[model samples]
Target: MDSGIITILLPLALAIIMVGLGLELTPRDFSRVGKHPKAVLIALFCQLVLLVGIAFVICKVLALPPLLAVGLMLLAASPGGSTANLFSYLFKGDIALNISLTAINSVIAAFTLPLIVNFSIQYFMNDGQQISLQFSKILQVFSIIIVPVCMGMLIRHFAPHLTEKLNKPLRIFAVLFLILIIVGAIIKESHQIMSYITQVGLATVIFCICSLMIGYFVPRLLGINSAQARACAFEIGIHNSTLAMTIALTVMANSAVAMPAAIYSIFMYVFAAIFGTLLNRFSRDDVSSRTTSPT
Candidate 1:
């Protein structure tokens, strides 16, 4: 809630979490994109294009306040969270594809996120409210994202054993930090929390369901295999809310602009688990039907 924490501690925490993400990554993750170009490209299109459109629609239809609308767009612009790999592994998705998507998406988001958020601010904040992500702020976003990731990659490349030792602890810290940021954002907006939720809750829930469905079904319809489709599902479904919130609180310096991400974080894991379970059930039924069919 404190400005000191927002400006200083929040970014430091995000850098550590991203560094942990980098430790999990390698040159292989980025290079692997070439091997599964279809899956990667499809996921990115769904994320960067379709989902952003969906969020904009939700914002307009719901008539969200300007800050909240921009927040939703910011969440939409975020890349897949590192946790998507874990979800993919649990749900029988292709983990390698998940990693590749995360790797590629992270790089792309550094450039696109600023552009998207800037557009949202300009378009939605037409109430004479002056909130703009200028060129310098864009560079800050780039450094906040890419620099730590590169640092972690270098550490892993040079001292893999050390990277291994740090990985689990850092992951645990990432989860805890995510929880803390959500709570902090909520508390900072405590007085308006219910009003904000009433305004943004349905939009976020609908957006989450649409995200998971679009992420999975579009890839499936496009001839991607089930395993790869599941990977696409989670990768596109689980956004890096911490990044959105950090940028909101620190970069834009608006707690209201952080609200959508904070609320969406609460719904994502629950919906993702339910969606993964349904996918597994369908996979099992398909296998049963195949095994029982005349051979």
Candidate 2:
């Protein structure tokens, strides 16, 4: 809640988390995208295009306040993180594909996130608000995201044993940092927390459901196999809310603009678990049907 924490500590925490992400990644993770170009392209389409459109519609239809609308747009723009890879592994999705998508999305988001958030600010904040991700702020976003990742990648490349030692501790820290940020955002906006939730809750829930569905179904319909489709689903479904919140609190310096991501973080894991369970059930049934059919 403090400006000191917002400007300094929050970004430092995020850099550590991004470094953890990089520790998990390697050069191969980026190159692997070439092997599953369809899955990658389809997931990106859903993430960058369809889901962004969906968030805009939800914002307009719900008549969200300007800051909240921009927050939702920011959340929609965030890339999937290491958490998505865990979900993919649990649900029997293509873990390699998840890693590839995460690797690619993180890079692309440095550019796309600023554009989307700036557009949302212009369109939704027609009330003469001065918040915009101008060129310098865009560079800040780029550095916050890419530099730590590159650092982690280099550490892993150069010192394999140190990377291994840092992995678990960083992962734990990332989770703790996320929880702290969400609580801090709520505390900062305590007076308006409930009001903000009432305004943005349904939009976030609907957006989450739509994200999971579109992430999976669109890929499936396009002839991607079930494993890869599940990977696509989780990758698109689980956004890097910490990144959104950090950018909101620090970059835009608005607690209201962080609320959507904070609230969405509460629901995303629950909804993702339920969705993954349903996918597993249906997958088993499909397998049973095939095994039982005349041969």
Candidate 3:
């Protein structure tokens, strides 16, 4: 794709993806959080606080370039996605909980994504980089994320049939667009692509594994059930990389800042699948042992 086409398609594709997300959500998804406040709260803490902190530490420890560091932070800020629910279902997690977390996280990310990305820009890109989200630009970023979501919600509310028809195609488009964006970003920085991957590849893989671990163990340690922990694991682990990439490419207008998310996207699905499989095996073992015991 040409740079001009990518520039136009990036935001447009993101809006379609957000609309697909909204179509999956309803008022009940948000309200469901009240039914499992502890799980919800713990998951959010892991996502918004713990995961972001972990990414920052990885960036600093790995000594990532400024744009890549900002990309990592942006990826950290992106919410969970429908893929989390799918992984949760396959791994015997509480799918309802995954859906609820994804819904609430999407809403929360509209505000937090801008803040985290801006902070990263200030901290990492301050030397001479011309990229920064001013106050007005912050609002623009928020609008780009939140407005389409709200519009989709309204469509789902008022025109459920149409939403149902559009949902699957939009989801397919979302996945395709994500791949194209990642490729575009990589190609844009092809001269430095190898270096970016060298600096970011291990950090992204480690961050993904850590995310799944923290999402599961943190909630489990707090006495949440294993099923719920599995849900949290995928929810916290499988971030909306498409959203992060869109913001980096479209909102920030910086392909360099999109690199981390692009790289992380490549690793996250593979890692999450492995993590979910391990969790499933453990769950089966626990069940088998219990069933065999004289209980």
Candidate 4:
């Protein structure tokens, strides 16, 4: 596929996803974070903190190239994405909370992602040359994730009967198609993907694990329950890699920078499934103990 085609494909798919997100949400969903500041703050802090910490370690200790490191940081900075709502629903998490967190986080990321990315480029880009940060790029990202999302929500708000009818199949299609995009990306880059898999692969796996851990414990350490912990784990830890890849291929125009998200895109679903299953098992144990203990 042409780089331009690859560029166009992901963003178009993401716009569809965002529109669905908005259709399912209301303005109240966007504001729910304020209603529960703890969950909101926990999700936001984990995302920002982990991006900086891991990007720093990857850049400084591992001495990875700047674009790759910045790519990883961008992955961290991106929000939970449309898929998380599915994951949250399947895992019996607070869907309302998940939707709210994703909405607020995606908006905040519009500003924060560029700042973190440019700083990482400054420190790690190897040649010490400035990384590009154009206003047009920011607008494109906003269009890709936010604008369509709001449009969807508007449709839902005005024509909720239709939205209610369409919501389920649209969500299903979005999930399945996004999976295909991930597969296509890997298949298209089969040879190079295999070659880069080991180096980028290991880091991607570690990042997912670390992200899950932080999303869960960081909240619980502050006293969030297991259910909310499960919610936070997926929401904070799972990033919108499609958006990250959009940035890399479109804005950054470097496949190496796109590699982290490609690698992560593969790993996150596997680990998220494993993590959700494990959390479910633990939750069952808690239920059993509580029933026996009369709480």
* RMSD to truth, every model: 1.0, 1.0, 1.5, 2.5
lDDT of each: 0.94, 0.94, 0.86, 0.76
Clashing pairs in 1: none
Candidate 4's C-alpha runs over 4 A off are: 127-131, 289-295
TM-score of each model, in listed order: 0.98, 0.98, 0.95, 0.89
lDDT of 4 by residue, 1-295 (tens): 4776667776787777778878877889877777778877877788788655875676566655566777787787777877777788888777778888888887888788887777777766765354565678777766777798888988997898989887888788776766776666667667777756755677778888988888888888998766677778888777888778777767776666777887888789889989888888988998799889954
lDDT of 1 by residue, 103-161 (tens): 89889999999999999998999852767798999999999999999899999999999
Q: Kindly report which residue stretches of model 2 are placed more than 4 angstroms away from their true locations once superposed.
A: none
Clashes in predicted model 3: 0
Separate clash counts for every candidate: 0, 0, 0, 2
lDDT of 2 at 12: 96
Better of 2 and 4 by TM-score: 2
Candidate 3: misplaced stretches above 4 Å? 1-3
